[model samples]
Target: MGSIDRYIFRTTLASFALVLVSLTGVIWITQALRGIDLMTSQGQTILTFLGVTSLVIPALVLVISPIALMIAISHTLNKLATDSEIIVMNAAGFSPFRLFRPFIYATCVVAVLVAFIAAYLAPDGMRRIKQWDAEITADVLTNILQPGRFAQLDQNLTIRIRERQPGGLLVGIFIDDRRDPKERVSIVADHGTVVKNEGGSFLILEDGNLERFEIDKRDPALVAFARYGFDMSKFSNQGHDVALGIRERYLWELISPPDDDPVYLQLPGQFRAELHDRFMSPIYPFAFAALTFAFLGAPRTTRQSRNFSIGSSILAVFGLRMAGFACSVMAVKSPFAPIVQYLMLLLAIGVSLWIIIGGIVIEPPASLIESINNANARLLRLFGRPATA
Candidate 1:
């Protein structure tokens, strides 16, 4: 019994690991292609980009593990059937469900690991990544302007650079800023650089021009060019200060949001959506696992189950899981939607159990077997092989 348990456990675990790694790799490659733009924009090193991308895997694994688990468990069981191990066990009077116990145990362990990542590690890592992005954005904004090109640093400010030298000096600069309606000003300079003055911070325009536009024609404009100076407001919106809602907050904080939390008010829909997602997503794994077994283990075949049950189960699981995720968006806002999702999940569970446990399919017709054999023969012939006797 101990050896059997160990064997089942090892096989199930290996299957789960294989599925997890393969799925993760697919998701990782797809995301990496898209993330390259971000990495390039921020001028991130390969290592930094990899590290940042790794931070999101916890959330991805948390999202995907259950589907992978279901597929893994189903494949393992099906493999046993193909290898005739299931037949040997049945002949020895071991109940059909006796095989699924180790898989269930493994699923439980997977659930725990998933919960930890979803609840804690992912959110923290996301926050750190966001912070780094903010820093990168600030650094870029401060120094990314090119000489002799019209550049808009931000809203209400357009700067034209004549030339920027190796000694960090900006020569022949034109600045048009309309940040303040009451005091819109424009300045042109022969040479200048952002430097700390005795007072605070000021832009010194030398040997160039300054023109302040006036609304009324009677109110004449003022132009000056003798190294005049103007104060520049260091408006900084650091990303560290901006909480990226569920991405940055801990599970507890997401569940019990603080009253003064700006994220809740600023983007209420997104906030609620993520909150509901985290809470509701766990149910999918159990739902899928049961569905897989329910669909497959039932309609058992004496020789080989040539039915489309395997393909059908895969489609059903994929469709149901996708529907659940799509519905989650609207479900979060409405109070009764979550309840409906839960009820539907429960119904699926009961259905799966009824099919698997209640001995659904029994003694399928010989014609069914002949049709399957014929189809297999055709398939083999198409691939240039002989049919079976």
Candidate 2:
């Protein structure tokens, strides 16, 4: 609420927002450009691509925000410190802890908001993105056949479309079926449409002829018909399996799968890793700012650059996060092997705590310690009597 606090808060927030926007723009551009092949192959529009990209922005922001805020506030503090603005505050009766209050408050706000998005919004967005991708793939595959071309649907069937009819109809259809070894059927229709039945797809011929052949002998029998219907049960989805990746599963499904699956096993590790990181992200702002402050705000006469400390802190946080990811990926592939998540957490926390606490001080400010103790402690006495053995 004070003048200096408001000044630092505004400056840091503006810088954080600038970095956040730039990062998002660059990442989205890269994603969209690299996905040109996928869009063309899958027959997805620009709007669909953008919609899918938009769903990931929340997750991206959740990833970069803690580090950005840490650097922004740390650099702001270091600039003030290196330029003797902090000395002015101290002369005006401000303590070191007093200067940290604004940073702490800002970190708390970022933490809670980022946690909400990372935990709830990010997963839901991921599901929507994957669903859209699946739809796009199916649409592309279904449109593989065009008119006036001999299109091979699969090994068992080939279709030739002579003309397109109104209202989702196909005219002049020819189908070759070669499933049975003893009998083969070839059908040609003059004016017909491909239709779908409750059981399978069928080609209804108004004026067509069916020729049946025997594989044992070179004999062909032709039947002329006014109206004939041919069954397309050959193309029925019978021995085909639709396999989707773990990224396609919902949270509950990911956690509790119906079967013992390789994909499910791999996903829990990723899910747990992400869940832990989200829970721990809010803590990054404090630890990173503290570490950078201790190193960059040390009694130095001049700053190397306007934002050196901020840049350094951001780099450090990113490095640590990547390290965590590397370990989590290994854990996902291995079975109960190399439990590295805890190690990654401890490494990050340990480095930050070491950098901050090595030279400065062990104790928090009186107000902070008092508040924490009061908020956390439980009464250990009965009838207001403190008894100890």
Alpha-carbon TM-score of each model against the true structure? 0.69, 0.59
C-alpha local distance difference test of each model = 0.69, 0.63
Model 2: per-residue Cα lDDT over 175-205, one tens digit each: 7866677888888888765455566656578
Clashing pairs in 1: 148-161
List ranges where model 2 is wrong by over 4 Å: 38-43, 78-83, 140-150, 154-274, 303-319, 333-389
- TM-score (C-alpha) between model 1 and the true structure: 0.69
Global CA lDDT computed for model 2: 0.63
As for model 1, its CA RMSD to the true structure in angstroms is 8.1
User: What is the TM-score (0 to 1) of candidate 2?
Assistant: 0.59
lDDT, residue 52, model 1: 67
Please report how far candidate 1 places residue 238 from its true position, in Å.
6.0
Residue ranges of candidate 1 with Cα displaced over 4 Å: 38-42, 141-143, 146-240, 266-272, 298-302, 362-389
